[model samples]
Target chain A: MSDTAQAARAVIGDSEFDRDTAVTLREPGVYGIDLSAGWTIINAVNGGYLLSVLGRALADALPHSDPFTISAHYLTASQPGPAVVRTDVVRTGRTLSTGQASLFQYDDEGREVERIRVLASYGDLDSLPDDVRTSVKPPSFPPMEQCFGPEDGPAPVSGSSAIAERLMLKLDPATLGWALGSPSGKGEMRAWFGLADGRDADPLSLLLAVDALPPTAFEIGLSGWVPTVELTVHVRSRPAPGPLRVSITTRNLAGGFLEEDAEVWDSADRLVAQSRQLARVRVG
Target chain B: MSDTAQAARAVIGDSEFDRDTAVTLREPGVYGIDLSAGWTIINAVNGGYLLSVLGRALADALPHSDPFTISAHYLTASQPGPAVVRTDVVRTGRTLSTGQASLFQYDDEGREVERIRVLASYGDLDSLPDDVRTSVKPPSFPPMEQCFGPEDGPAPVSGSSAIAERLMLKLDPATLGWALGSPSGKGEMRAWFGLADGRDADPLSLLLAVDALPPTAFEIGLSGWVPTVELTVHVRSRPAPGPLRVSITTRNLAGGFLEEDAEVWDSADRLVAQSRQLARVRVG
Candidate 1:
């Protein structure tokens, strides 16, 4: 790997999200990430991690600088290595800019295949005018001290994926019915999350934070990794700067697939990020 | 105009959606839409109409004919003209296939510029596994007879955009607080909808139907066409062949932006589609 690619891979393996998202802007609309092997879920990487990589590029590429909303359509699985981020600005307004980006890598034959394509709007959070707020509220769960992650609860069989080890998780214990060999029967998980590397919650980290919770479908008795096919992330507001409180809920698990909706609130109780994805359902 | 362009333009102007979405699949991974002028929301075309066009490309691009989920990011505002739809298949499984599509139009300079980029998953709704369904029910509204659309709605002082005239909509009278010179102050609208041309609700029409309702922010007094920044449409199941029952609600109107969640039920009373969008909030 080139020194640049090696450096990006280091960031991906690093636990500090700030470090992970420290994407090097090689030039206009070109950002590169040095992806490490540890970020892999099985062999291919976790889609959310790649989203953060692109999110970092997007936040820097535009004047708004905040990923107010982003959605990624996974085209192919991105392998662990040097990957390139390419972006195009469609329309830039005083408030928001419309753009699209692709995360890609070249095969040994020198052909580029994009792994993900994102259409996003970057905006300044401060510019949003206040309106009559709605009554939608995040679910209240016990604070961080009362939560336990997959490792702290029912340990996965001996060899867990390295990606599992890298995630610093704290899932609410009350929702861990799956740990007792009995599933909650409801695909939902609420927890407090941040990077194991201790990076504070920022726009890019918030993107990763929403997807960090183990698939809510796991508690409902499904097995295997439910890879996200398409994900839509709505950055409601900037986080209050802390480990985000997250709720991942799957309303219906049907048709060999399911939809997972995530709500992420900052410590101050402000809803910071919301995301929904359609994923293939593997019934184990 | 060439015969092909004229034929395509006719489809867009036609009120019938099934025929409008009959995108010409020239070959695998390629579809085309003859653009027409009436779909414009003011000078720029409505974003939702573009999505349905892409949805048509996707459903036909894959083996699974039903559009289970689609999310679109508008790159550039497409004018009324000829556009090519190109799709790239990422993964095609027996049940669900993951893919991405781009709609491109040539500029006066003859450069191909993308107008929309979409990531979607195609699935057979019938194959969804049964689960403990949620009890969250739809709101009880007066049957379609009590609702009235914009024409029957508070008459626009003068020339309204032709796009408004093309939609056959009727809002449940209770939610039209803005019409009385008194805003409901709450961002919500429950309405019954169908295309003025009388198109049946399929996956693509269902996509347009959710966006068909006036932005919920309108009821709360926000004015000017609030353009959709990003839209994610999840087709929970195929819609029954009829006009859809739509309930549009904005959970929180903050930072000059808000999230609109739409639940569309078919005549059979089954929830056929659900969508969420992030749109600009313009205070009147």
Candidate 2:
């Protein structure tokens, strides 16, 4: 319906995930990209997808390659367009390098908008100690046929959103309060996530998968635009193939403030990424 | 030993927790306080105390008073001094007000040292729906007398650290890897934490309690000072009076990086606060 949305779809269809998330070098610490709006929820883009874009830039500058950890502070809501990413290497050690990446965009008046500042660590996951292996058990799911997704038919409630077209989110209808028209009255959402284009979710793609689900706050009877204030994602293991099963829970919803904890498990049933965020419960 | 440390102890000793955690409002969005070093872990003060200090400042500027969620990024190590806290209102909505606070101190060069930035939410905990109650089971503990703390006698191996002199941390002993001279190899630590001065632990105090345990990495036989890269804390309920039970687990220790998740339960056995961190395995 909009020119930007049309452009986003074109860019996404024309490029692969590596290219869709690509950042071109602009000197040493500066990088730039024309962000596609294909992953937006209404007007705001998904937080994890934004972080993946920034993480890609930060990871490239580090000696080691894998993004071990990423903490993103959403300074302001941003839209699709040309954005600049600047990286500042804070601490470099033998095993990890900590860096801060700030994404900026210019307003119509040409004033710069500081959208996000991501604090991240890049290291070699392959080098981790395989001897000391332990994990929080991955959550179980019902039969795949019982789940709802683009494959099931078409997006019903979120059909108009760009992300619905870009991501294949098979939500467990038991927790889909919006679809059932009866809130679960609990703060939880479970879904199986993968790219609509069938691209394997690497650590970077796993970042986007964390935020791909509809806000779990809906299950608690809080209907609104749940904007993230700060999000911290921890990459646990190299994800296995197939759809990553995810569980997002909001344990405390007090005074319109809630925290969402999302655990992403790969098809092999191993935990891949763990994310927790602090957000205000916006009741629209 | 230092004047700032002495000042911190006096302030902490003289007031009740409510007053101790209260920040003096100098102006709108500006807060000032004489920070205490009584909660230091070796040379670097405990991350939770710093977070509590910053949380106090941000909560003061907000319309709602309780800090339901806090995610802090420690940019650099700080010391006891007159810390200046500045809060920036990021998002103000019907039920939540998300604000960012930066705590700054002047270094010996008279230059400003931005030690930490805290993203926090202030809201009414009483407004939470009581009917939808659930929690992960709290860990069990042996008799209080069987645990280890300063009052129990000597510190054993950790006694050399100044933090041992400052707080009372009673470990379960079953996972006290360093003290037992045998690593559990399970990557876990369980303990009971309370203020040393006999003060009841409040929400702010609960922040400190989360990081007060011995590094769980030590249980897996990883030695050294593990510095937290980023920490996200979720306060579920106003803690009940008495010592809080805690369980710390390190699921994956890889490539010189590890994650520690800490869950806290109040005396009444309610989940009070939960925290997880990404840290560099700094083996000194």
Q: Each candidate's lDDT (Cα)?
A: 0.74, 0.75
Candidate 1 Cα outliers beyond 4 Å, as residue runs: A1-15, A24-31, A40-44, A60-64, A105-113, A126-134, A150-168, B1-15, B19-34, B40-44, B59-64, B75-115, B123-135, B150-166
- Candidate 2 lDDT over A1-284, as tens digits, reads 33332353333224455666799999998999988888777888778889989999998877777787777777678788899999878667677677778889998899878888776777777777654354467777876678887546543657768877767678888887666678788788899787766666788887888788878877777678888867888887788767789899987665455678898988876777888887766688
**Shift in Å, residue A33, candidate 2:** 3.8
- Kindly state the fnat score of candidate 2: 0.24
Estimate, for each residue in B1-284, the C-alpha lDDT of model 2 and write its tens digit. 22333343333325434444567888889988877656566677778778888887777788876676676766778786688898887666556566778888898898877777666666666676554244356778866678887556544646655656555578887887566678888878888876655566776677778887888878887788898877878777777778788889887665566788888988887877778987777777
RMSD of each: 5.8, 5.4
Model 2: clashing residue pairs?
A128-B254, A128-B255
Tens digit of per-residue lDDT, candidate 1, span A46-143: 77788988887887787778888888877677888888899887678777776778888888897987788787888887666654375577787887
Best by TM-score: 1
What's the true lDDT of residue B183 in model 1? 71
